[model samples]
Target: MKIEEVRQHVTTPLTAPAFAPVVPRFTDREYLNIVYRTDADALRAVVPEPLQVEEPLVRFEVMKMGDVSGYGPYTESGQAIEVSFDGERGEYLHAMYLDNFPATASGREVSAYPKTAGSPKLYVDNGVLVGTLDYGTLRVATATMGYKHHALDVREAERQITVPTFMLKTIPGYDGAPRVQELVRTEITDVVVKEAYTAPARLQLFQHVLAPLADLPVLEVVSASHIRTDLTLAPVKPVFDYLKGVRS
Candidate 1:
């Protein structure tokens, strides 16, 4: 291939790419979000600087992707910590685990998402909404909630999911030195909330050497929401470049 062709198709494998060049759009994406209070010190230790943690809150989410543009149906589970940047309220993505290889590759390579490969399932068992995450056949996290017990305001659900999300992107050079390090932010826009509800919920996180979600022990279950929507994720933009600042 010519140099120009190589430059244009340098995504993953030089011969074949896993996913197409298309913006991800989800249809009937369901979310089970449980916002709980955790230890403030734990939040401080994980959350990066320039981001302040006002409340010791973490949102544990299990997402069921019904239909996506490029990738097919998959389930994802992760945690986001409540944080603020430059006086703007947002959530910092701590970790994400899913089962899809293409989605995981694109998330980490293209968007710099903190994604890892794991087994996560979100389904309705009997009349209860159940979400579980396991690593290598070992259960790490489990959450249960009443299935649509009370109706929730659609606007509130939209607001909750549309909050600005921040993530740290880091890449090392061939010599094992820091090459790219920055803080990026993104939001989910173009959403149509199909259903939203509230329910009594409980979370249980087990101690895992790999998936250390239990590091932030659940102090109190502040709120839980069951929402279904069709949305598209916006492209991420870098807000702070740590390496660039250090070079100057």
Candidate 2:
């Protein structure tokens, strides 16, 4: 789809002109407290926009599907990540303190904002990132990398049918504690390689910051069947709504 067509129906601030929704989009949000210390003089140094307790909240929905007329049974897979923010908190904090702080601004309030990650076409050639075909609107594409204890080059990836899906997990038994691990575990299933393009942009987003989380950890990806959507009434307010008011 043309970029403008994709963005026409979207009012989301984070949207670009490239892609648009094929279905009703959804967003989920939650507040996370970041413990820190703020200086009286430091906060005074920066001012902010007038605070508005209410702001429009929106979530984006996207799905891909295909059907074979002669087929007996259908197959598909669906996955959705929480649409959120981190930068909004920073911006909101900057605005409010500068514009709304009391004469003796002494401290800070718990704050949070939207955090989103996208996948762009990417693959590394000669150790340099290079562009490739866009893969089905996916912000990130899962590429078959090293196999069964063997690290393979990007070119040699398709040769291995059995691939791993990487996953970042919270220490399974640990309480709401903070810890994450990346591990490669999975093999491919009955499949079709109709489109193949090496995506290079992934290199930039996968940084040292996410090293503690799942980085190219392998996943056992089978030929997934077409997704079967389960529809239900959405809630009055999703996550981002509450986030808009959080003091950053």
Candidate 3:
């Protein structure tokens, strides 16, 4: 392709890109979020600067995406630390693991999601909502909750979904140096909460070298929410630059 055509491309592999540039809209997106308290020092070690841990809280989430604009359907599970940036409460996404390749590729390449390939499943099993994540043949995380035991306020569930999200986006230079290092922020929008509920939940994290979610160590289960919504994933904008020490 010509240089002009190359400039128009949004991602690599001009012949057949891994994912399209369409903004993904998730329909019937189901989420099981378990917020728990962890060690304060563990939170500090993983959460980067400019984001402060207020109460040593972490949210473990399992998302079952029904229909997506570009990615079709996939199940994703990850952990986010409850943090504050600029005095505003938000979540700093630590890692995301999913089963879809295109979604994983596009999420990491075009957006700030720390995406990786893994086996994650979310389903109802024997009258309980279960979410599990496995790296290779080893189980990394498992969460179980009562299936929609009590109704939750739609506005509160919306707030949980719309909370500002922060992530560190890093790109390495060709010469083995830092090229792009940014703290990006984004939030979900245009949400239509179909249903939401609260339930008793329990989580277990196993040790794995690559997926070290157990490092946080769940101390106490603060709360849990099961929300089903139709929403859009908003684009990310760099709020702070680690290399330059200012907004990029």
Per candidate, the number of residue pairs that clash is 0, 41, 0
User: In terms of TM-score, which candidate is stronger, 1 or 3?
Assistant: 3
Clashes of 1: 0
At residue 190, candidate 1 shows an lDDT of 99
Give candidate 1's whole-model lDDT.
0.93
Candidate 2 stretches with Cα past 4 Å from truth are 1-116, 119-157, 166-168, 171-175, 178-184, 195-248
lDDT of 1 by residue, 32-124 (tens): 999999999999999998889999999999999999999999999999999998899999999999999989988987897899989999999
The local lDDT score (0 to 100) that residue 27 gets in candidate 3 is: 99
Query: Which residue runs does candidate 1 get wrong by more than 4 Å?
Result: 246-248
- Give the candidate order by descending TM-score: 3, 1, 2
After superposing all C-alphas onto the true structure, candidate 2 shows an RMSD in angstroms of 20.3
Q: State the displacement of the C-alpha of residue 55, model 2, in Å, after optimal TM-score superposition.
A: 50
Leading candidate by TM-score: 3
**Candidate 3 positional error at 132, Å:** 0.4
What ranges in model 3 sit over 4 Å off?
A: none
TM-scores of the models, in the order given: 0.97, 0.20, 0.98
